[model samples]
Target chain A: MLILHCPYCGVYAEETELHAGGEAHLKRATIGDSDEAFEEYLFMRENKKGVHLERWRHANGCGKWFLCARDTATLEVYGTYPAQTTEPPADIVAAITAKHPGWSWKEKA
Target chain B: MSNAVSALNGQEAKGDVTVRELGLTGMITLRGDFEDENFGAALSQITGAGVPDVRHFVQAGDFTVLWMSPDELLVILPYEKAAETVAAFDAALKGTHFLAVNVSDARALISISGDFANEVLAKLSPVDMSADRFTAGMVRRTRLAQVAAAFWMLPDGSYNLMCFRSVADYAFGLLSTSAKAGKVGAI
Candidate 1:
């Protein structure tokens, strides 16, 4: 079985944990003051096949949040971090909000 | 603020031993800036393991140090060891800004083992339990049947579920139903 390094609980048996998020690093482009730009940001993803950062929860462990990097192709994980330490890149955040008009970070939170 | 649990009222069920399966696991809450030299060393001395960094967990045999928040930790041990552990921890932090509380019996922990355990949990939680995504030795604070609980995946396929003792009775029903339905995985 693949070893999942939970940014929170260390490495654990994969069958008992839960995946909670995708890598939040994609950027959205502004569409010349158009709502389409915002919409694009709200409904897009890379769904890449290589190393991807994601969020996971040890649903049965200590109950904490953590980040993880994995190889979608081989299902091999590279590393992981606590969610607090893994902030979405600023550019990606701006793009996503720009693509989705009225989709400000405050609103998302 | 602490969440406390009272003894269960006089309620009975079929085959229900008079003792409300009200599982009680005492937890000591410790909060401090681990970066502080004294704090780190003191915690390690008491727990026999370094204080876990942000969002991590450190296990010293029966003692589990879970990073509950940025500066908060939950130390869990068997009830019988609570006194000794707390005393050692308290002495180590004689002059620190750390907070240690005796929360023994605050939460009830139940071990749900067997093949269908994951399936039963899936019915009530949205977490992805596929082996690669989430694994054993990990812990997460989440909800079950909309009730708050901490889920711990042990090295074995069993799940250690911890919830406030106040809801012990309610959780028992759900767990029993799931087990009877064979949702707890193969025994």
Candidate 2:
């Protein structure tokens, strides 16, 4: 069972206590955007093999959703942060870069 | 009082860990800004115990208040006092962004007490149930079997668990089966 800390409740919740919210930091492309952008928003995903940023709901725990930075290959969770913000925190990005050099997510490079 | 009978009213117990439905337990889902300066005082006016810290609880006799989230609390009181407590909260937090809802009928509170209580829970719960990790007064929102549940340890090393009313029967079955196996911390 994978254990991830919920940023809101401050508890290390197991997978059974949480629900996966899919890829994180996806920019919502509303009606005004082009068809490609809209399609990307709805279906396109990074699908990275090494590092990944995803959203998870602490469904049974605090009932709050949070973002996780981890390695898809090793299942090594770098960190988890609150989901209120539109982007990952600076420290988390740095930590990921330090562990897995040249790793990037979304538009951050 | 609610017409709901204890969920275990017709059930049989065959395990060392005793499980019984806690009937007619008054519960109020109190939602408010935890950082509000008047929040503690207003809740104290109704529930003798102040709003507990995150994942922590405070008890005043039979009345206890547990913090479920940043803005949520589960207030447990006697069924008779349920009405008065809700009224008090309404009167006190008139202009606040708060919701005091009576949820006594919507959820089932169960008491699992005994030496093997911890072991039975440990079998199904993913959270560390060892005494060193889960001490008294600490509460956790997690799954008991496939349903969402919350439980906290009592001073006497027992447990008070709460689950949705709809899943009470399923929860009881899971607890009983786990207890009957008598496996100590083997998932």
Candidate 3:
């Protein structure tokens, strides 16, 4: 079992713990485009052989959104990074400290 | 007055929310890499509770499996067996590639029984608690109010939920509201 590190949830399983959200770099087709254009964008498939990036949900872990890259054939994951990262997004430490003015975050884990 | 009687009478006073006062049971958090055979052996030796090969659980007397993650699991034992199980686990897992944490103080096991238990659970948890999906000897590690939790289905058709004691009151309140809403067609 490959331990996939979720940038937010930390390391998790490669199976049901994470969900494959499909191929990355999917861009919307321009409006007023021909049927052929839409068809090529939607129905067509590259079925790439190697080094493909995708999206995944850490359903069991931290539940944070992130991206992942892997080999389609060998199922060998290359790397994973946060998909939606923000500066102090709902900072758990700061929030807790604010709630408890006397409590020390450094002392508590 | 007895704690259980006070709780039953709905006249019990609240103490530290994180520190359980009443109507809670043993909650031991077992963290280990299941990929290790030695860990499995140590686990079996510890609580006399073997990590079942399946996704759910198979009880061994008083102990019950609560959560079986890829690398960790949470077992819910009776209050009487708490210290013994913890010590046994510590002894077996000593110097091994495993971490047995006694989180009895961290999490609370609330018994949600009676006729409206399922309806109450349906409010916060996404699990389908119908008999077919969730029967006796079944356990599900899911989310409650978007927080991680483990729900164990008992032989009596009741659900023993293991969640952080800090969130127990909030979760219970949510469940109670949902149950009442179900009765009044408020949903």
Chain A TM-score vs. truth, each candidate: 0.57, 0.92, 0.59
Report iRMS values in order: 6.0, 0.8, 7.4
lDDT of 3 by residue, B1-187 (tens): 5432212222122221111223545657788877678777876666577776434675777676644555567776776677788788788777877777767667655666656566567666655666576677766665776566667667877666666767767666665555555532222
lDDT of 1 by residue, A4-86 (tens): 55554454535344545655433556757557667657775557655455667655444566766555787765455566664
Q: Find the candidate with the highest TM-score and give its number.
A: 2
Of 1 and 2, the candidate ahead on lDDT is 2
* DockQ of each candidate, alpha-carbon based: 0.12, 0.81, 0.05
Residue-level lDDT tens digits of model 2 in A10-63: 998877888998899888998779999898889988888878899999998889
> Which tens-of-lDDT digit does each residue in B1-187 have in candidate 1?
6654433432322221111243345578888886899888877777777866554467888788877655678888776677787787788888877888877666666666666666666655545666665567666565677577766666776676667777867776676665556534321
Best by DockQ: 2
Scored against the true structure, residue B15 in model 2 reaches a CA lDDT of: 53
Better structure of 2 and 3 per DockQ: 2
- The parts of candidate 2 lying over 4 Å away from their true place are A30-37, A107-109, B1-4, B9-15, B183-187
TM-score of chain B of 2: 0.92
Task: Give me the displacement of residue B169 in model 1, in angstroms.
Answer: 1.0
Error of 2 at B4 (Å): 4.6
Ten-residue stretch with the least lDDT total in model 2 chain B: B6-15
